[model samples]
Target: MKDHHPHKSLDDVHESVPIHGGKSKFKRVISFFGPAYLISVGYMDPGNWATDLAGGSQFGYALLWVLLMSNVMALLLQSLCTRLGIVRGKDLAQCNREIYPKRMNFVLYVLAELAIAACDLAEVLGMAIGLNLLFGIDILWGVLISFADTFLLLYLQRLGMRKLELFIVGLISLIGMCFLAEMFFAQPELEEVVTGFVPSLPNSAALYIAIGIIGATVMPHNLYLHSALVQTRKIDRDEHGIRKALKYNFFDSAIALNIAFFVNAAILILAASVFHKNGMHNVAELQDAYHLLGTTLGTEWAPKLFAIALILAGQSSTITGTLAGQIVMEGYLQLRISPLLRRMLTRLLAIVPAVIVIIVFGDEKVGQMLIFSQVLLSMQLAFAVIPLIHFVSDKEKMGAFVIGAKIKFFSWLIAVVIAFLNFQLVYEEVTDWLSEIDNVGLQACIVAGALGLFVLLIMTIVYPWILKRKPSRSDIHISFDDLEFKQASSFRTILLALDFSKSDEKVISQVLQYNPAISRLILIHIVESASVKYTGGQSDDYETRKDLARVEQYAKFLKEKGYDVLFELGYNNRIKAIRTMCGKYSADLLIVGSHGHNGLKDIVFGETVNKLRHAVKIPVLIAQ
Candidate 1:
């Protein structure tokens, strides 16, 4: 993980290149390109390879449409992430910390880390299998070799961030070329290949693989990582700059990810063509794919190309995965640690579980475990996606940069679809596995575990909704610590509205007794635009100048007593201003001097004091 300390200032890391105008529009667009590529790598990681392979080999290109749908979702999500980073000047995790309370930040951090660890597990396991396939190395030894790549990442950090990015780009390119060569050797029928892009599930078994493909493609950690990555360049930090960055970042993500789409689609196409077509429908294992690609294609170079691509995919992904882990930890928790220590710790979190799975289940089951790991990722998707939706959709946080109605509709649609599908997949898979077990005690334990997971999944989806549920405005339930004190005031805070009537001075005099208990006060005066306007130094209207003078006199009198006052002037009528002030100030009590009105006259014209008393939940004191 590169040194991305979350609490650090914007100027702490790279000397960001300025994205000012005067360069050609194209050149400015090029400057914002690197962040999206960093994100695009996550889309094509070794985890994706597992699902694509499983989908293709068993389903025979039937899951290609899942890949395509997953990419479109990825593009929309990542583009929102890009805009979030540019507009808020904070990453998703940082925004989470800012918008949410500390408890939620903790929960989000844990889920995000789990997603990263799950992703890392895939990358680490993929590299091991790749090593076992390309060379004669054992899987356990390859898992050990995976840790040494962290040191390589550290070394690359010294060369500069751009160089590290270029290296990953090179790896991406290499992996693409290797697969393109495989496509050449296998020579899939184009007509049949294109049919995969039309949606179909020929087998129910393909459903798990479809879920894995979606989960692996649109990752949780990448959302947090990309929001931070786009801030790498020192953007103009204005309306025009944000517009330009959003435009170009979307382009960068689309272009880079379409390349990823090709790499992913190619893998499936190769699997469908090479293995599924040749009576090898169950070749879901990466090792099996490697072994069969050579014999099936009748070319010695084919399997070698496959193994090399797998190794590159694994190594490249782990680099970014580690970086994302670092970002998640630091951004959510405000944590800072040595990059070396943090990387090893994160890798261990992945390696220990993976090593346990391989040891307990053996090598043959690791392939199934890989696909399961991705499904685990899918389960946690709701937690990450919900908060991201809340953040980008809010007009308050995003300002003019908030997503439009159409984008909001589609983004939410994607979120809801992913969440619903993930929960459904988990439910079906857990119940199916439970039914297979015959031991009563173990079955009870498994059932208990599934119930626990079900509850957790429910909470992950429910928590954001819980946060969004607005606190209802209940009537003030005022009480004192002692019953004897009930006759005394319960008001520690007060809102006093001045109407500048004959009783205004009397109301001011009455507030002295409450001053002993009152710690804060808010004074509001409304100058209705229909009644008065700010008439330069003097007004043609006599009432306007008199009203301004009265407010100033009251303000000066209040200041002389060293009272803490928040004075506000509204351009509306007194009734509306006082009514709104109750909510704005969260007033414990409202005080205003009423114009003594008799029966029919009070009913015909509105009484501001009477109106406020009826409208607000707080007690209103009217001094005549």
Candidate 2:
């Protein structure tokens, strides 16, 4: 005999009407699936394609195992991210700000942002090069053309996020088909391809390429995007719904990633069989591969297939990269730069160097710049991975869904290895550059400077490990119990902010559940601008009517629960209104929903409820 009362359980409202509606069950599922999968594969951008192709062409399938292993690792990490978002109802960037110290959090945010920007540069360059190959446009003109494509992609987003996702899926499928066609035409020797899966490091360069492959596949921005996108689902916090969401998310990620894996493997295997066998070693571009296709396969079909695939690969990656930039900006900074502005920023950063190179040194120099951007990506991987590993491993924070011992150990090991490899890559590049200096005095000066920097690096790494500080009481702030709300005595009033969203309803219900002693409930809905029209006019008469209707509905709902209910309505800027309402109503406890903000604003401003805490000297209860 289950309880029939609404106050006794949340499951009673689990099947309540959703704000967004559709005609069929299948339509609902389809609607939820698009954002996670299409958006996640954006991590596998044009830079990844370049690295995969370069690895196969140079090392002849020796590095194929890296992609296989990295994808598995990526799956585990992304699952943790999705779980974190579902459990906390907040994105990874916001979670980081909560868990880490302010200075450290800001530093991590900057590094992660830089990595995304670098990856975007690579995607833009790849798209330009692909356009040049397919349409016979000049590389410079192609770069500008790719910039134009950004506006078109953002326009599709205005149709709805789902439409944009569907369009990307179509592009990805087309690219996958092109690769499948090439794989069929090339027909690599099966035995050698099978042996490539055994994982052998032939040389230092092969090891480096393997590192690049892993770095390119498991990107930082995808973690942020996937976690944030999962929240768009209408799923409740019920155990059953959570389990189902996780299961579906896993299926969604696996299918999308497997397609990515096939495309990656086909590119590697095709290059290995076609280019590596011949003594012609220095395959610089996709065009270089096209030239070999005609000569090696004894057919014109191979080159044509390669060119078409390259075009698809480049175009698909570009769209995703831009989307990632948007997510990062929105999630970390709590600022929305329109898509066109974001694209222009990315293009200018990538193209300035590329255009200068083509003008002075030629198009060949731009190819080197593309590889340089990939190397830059490899360097920044650790900044994002370390924070993710630390946060997911915190048992108190993540509860039962925290990362297991085995997963934590393996991920940490990978992070350490990647950090070391990035250091070596930076060291080698610097040393090689220094060695090329013709003047002996200048070369000696450069060597001395490098040695000094290396010593500082050694000190920075060792000092933290050797002189660890004892954990102090000052380090602690609010605990879990502190966040839990308690009812004030019967004489006090409680101010609750409502957005008319389901999330707001949850907050109200939570307040009634925990603290039934309230004398009155003051409901607030801030009107941001005076000129901004509501469903009715902005006149006082219309506003008063709207407020009365909302208050009456809430009063009726509370009366059915057998509680004396009273409501008041106010309008102003959200933060300002919260402060004013708190003082005027003399709120014993401020109850507000956590939504609309992310990252640092979520930490400093404290979302909706958390923000009220700093503004007013009162206990703010954040209802998730």
Candidate 3:
């Protein structure tokens, strides 16, 4: 292992929430409440509403068993996520990066991102439709307006995780309240509602919607998000503490996900009672559902409540999408960017396709688009789910906390079931596409892409179980508290790289004071003048001569102190040049001055000392 701190998951809020395990039992349980509620919002987002509405309207509550089944699966998988985070101290993305090779991690990262984009597309469309239904805004403008939620996310993040959790829970409560009123107005038949949970598919179309409901309910991104979110609560690492956390997190997931299950069931029931009863079996479009709810239920508030709930669901889910995007990008790629940029990039990916669909196909197509996005999530589900199961079941990594035989069996069962449904859906859809396309080249291309993805999916399913080894524990020992001091070793030959600035005086002063036994000084400067950069030492321009004079002068000043000094001048990339000169002189240490610049300055004007340290093999000392 490398000698560096492991990157934290959801680093802004890692261990930010206090567990308060020493407090009253009720108080201790309350600390575990927020993460699951944040997670549950994803389960009941606009994606769920879209799937539920489509499933109920088309199949008339026949697919409600799918929702129930999906919620149960979500509970199990989310508990596994909690187990992974608490026991391993890493999120799912981080675990994948550590276990899988880089190229493989990249593929998983892309799939994770595609899942987020698909999830966000549902939110974008849901938000836009809510605005359009309530305020009569154009769909394109509403989607364009959805871009502003990036700022909302930024503001909420600044307020902290506890507050963000509060906001999400409030929105979820609002959605719950809205649905309760809808269920009352719709008055779904009790016997038929009971019958919906008997686990039967009415037709092939119902099977597709059933899969969408499963996709929306057991979302892939939530798996990654929950693991990282659970880490926000500060807890003891002892056995009793871990056991306590697992129990409370389980309760948290159950309570929150049950609420989500109710919300989904309510959407399906409302659509089934009002639309199916009225012989309006094709009420899959959200706009159609909104307009029909008022007249069909004979109440004006029905549509109003529906739109309000849709807006809340879309807004709340958008926040989690931002966090998941941050997790996968940072975890899989070890890349971090400003939250603002990340949010914009994610929303933009969803927005462009949404706006294009609305403009080309119009608002009538938005509902299908939403359903398609959920199905896309289903297709990507196996990639995340398989690796998560593999991780939790690994005894070497998880130790005593490894999931037992039952959980191991059921988790893999869930993965297989999801893969089976996705494969069936692909088979049907591909067959339809192939038959419709008359061009041989297009058909060949489609077949090739399908085969390639199938191969990748198979690789993802088997790689962790068969080939991966648990990463070796770090060998380097570190003592944080036990302190020891010894006489400082001095550098025998020091290389000082400088710019023609007054900071050079401070740099030389620091070197002389820090390393008194320095026997030789190699003063070097890299002239970056336009004329000499590409030409290197071959260009003898006036700017190069001026840099030469500055270097010689510095050498002369150092020599006066009775030290042997040699000056070298080079051009082009300063980092490479300094590295070459360091090796050329056999210097033990390289000293460079800080520009006191960071952030945008480092981006625009490169930070030489930072780059030079990594480019060279010797010790680098930065002078303040």
Top lDDT hit: 3
lDDT of each: 0.77, 0.66, 0.85
The list of candidate 3 runs beyond 4 A from truth reads 1-8, 94-106, 151-155, 184-192, 297-301, 329-344, 355-365, 395-399, 456-505, 514-593, 596-620
Error of 2 at 612 (Å): 28
Better of 2 and 3 by lDDT: 3
The weakest ten consecutive residues by lDDT in model 2 span 1-10
Give Cα distance to truth, residue 589, candidate 2, Å. Answer: 33
The sequence of per-residue lDDT tens digits that candidate 1 reaches over residues 564-620 is 667666555566667887788898988888777867888796677766778889888
Q: Compared with the true structure, what per-residue lDDT tens digits does model 2 show for residues 294-333?
A: 8888878777766666666666666656655665554455
RMSD values, in order shown = 20.8, 12.3, 5.4
| Model 3 lDDT tens row, 1-624 | 111235578888898999775759898899888899988988988877767878888888888889889889999999999998888888889888877877878888998999999999999999999999999999899999999888998998889888999999899999999999998898888999999989898888888887667756788899999989988888887878888889999999999999999999999999899998889888877888999999999999999999999999999999899899999888888788988999999999999999888889887788778867876787778888888998889887788788999989999898888888766766766788799899999999989977877888888777776884646321122444456888976788898989878778778997666444456888888888888656655478888888888888888887777778888887888887888888898888888888778989999988887777789999998888
Error of 3 at 111 (Å): 2.2
Local distance difference test, candidate 2: 0.66
State the weakest 10-residue window (summed lDDT) of model 3: 472-481
Better of 2 and 3 by TM-score: 3
Each prediction's TM-score against the native? 0.70, 0.66, 0.80
In candidate 2 the C-alpha lDDT for residue 523 amounts to: 66
User: Candidate 1: what lDDT?
Assistant: 0.77
Q: TM-score order of candidates, best first?
A: 3, 1, 2
